[model samples]
Target: MSTTVLHARTLPGDAEQRWPARLWGVLAVLCLVVFLDGLDGSMISIALPSVGHDLGMGTASLQWIVNGYYLGYGGLLLLGGRAADMLGRRRVFLIALGVFAAASLLSSVAASGSLLIATRFVKGVAAAFTAPASLSLLTTTFPEGAQRNGALSVFSLFGALGYSLGLVLGGVLDGFGWRYVFLMPVPLALLALVVGWKLISRDRRPRPGRRDHADRGRRRVR
Candidate 1:
């Protein structure tokens, strides 16, 4: 009789690993970055009066300043998502954050209304890439079922909090200078980039064989 040792295979969902504490830290960093994006988006709106005064922008130009950023952001979202999927999410997220920080810096240093508006358009494009990629990364990192639900809930809560905080912070920063609102995200984005690079490892799972093939077939049918 031959004796054989058999090891049990754990299913993806059946793995008994608990949520690591580092995951929370990563999540918090992601939240802060997302919050900054939200804050920056609204900060200009609240500070428009001050901005117009400083830059001598008229009403029509002011409207263009705001509208241009939105148009750029919304128009590029689909492209951003596809890019995130094609490139690595982590790589794209960091690149977007870098672009966003650069744009914020430019906005802060802008001497004219047109310069500021142009910077805002760049920032919006950067955000289009960063936001969805960050969320998709979080979803992919966290295990599914209860843990994933909890993580998503926390992410959503931070998003809501960021929006409310932005409104309050915008008012306060407006009193100081309109530039500070734009400058604020620079440090936060930097911090997030650092933490994300240090703590998050690339996903190393081998692509599922049959499922992947089936998915490709479905896509072809579509």
Candidate 2:
């Protein structure tokens, strides 16, 4: 009898994939931004009564505050994702997050109902960009495998937790002032922005020639 041995073959793309050394830090930053986006979406709902009373906004005008956010969020969501693909994901995420933070600060000091609603709309647009960019960044950062799946689960958990926690936090912050509800996210956003800039890797744009070649190859394949 002769002894036989077989060698295992490495799958395609297996060699090209690499996980970042600071993956946990990157994931945490992504999660924090996602949580803040979710929190901002719902946090003001509970503070509406206080807002209306303080700002002298009627029920109809107050509704615009909430509607403004949803309008911008839903309207630009698809465009935001496309923007991330064309522009750099890291760049889009950082810019959007910065806008989100600034909008939060402005909302806190908004003198009129119209100004506050506009700030909320801008925040929603920023969230639309950040959400997709962060998700795409997560996928690229963690190679496809169990680790990526686990990271995704954690990321999703934070998003849901934010919305649920927002209602509770809104009530608590409302006790101080309606403005406090808006102010709460400002610090969190700023912290995430700073951390994200440090932790997230820079996007590598393909050289013009390489990109043209890639497009040609894809066209041939199609």
Best by lDDT: 2
lDDT values, one for every candidate: 0.82, 0.91
Q: Flag clash pairs in model 1.
A: none
What would you estimate as the lDDT of candidate 1? 0.82
Task: Judging by TM-score against the true structure, name the best candidate.
Answer: 2
Name the TM-score of candidate 1. 0.82
TM-score of each: 0.82, 0.86
Per-residue lDDT over 187-215 for candidate 2, one digit per residue giving the tens place of the 0 to 100 score: 98889899889989999986779889999
Q: Where in model 1 is the C-alpha error above 4 Å?
A: 1-18, 203-222
Q: For candidate 1, what's the RMSD?
A: 8.3
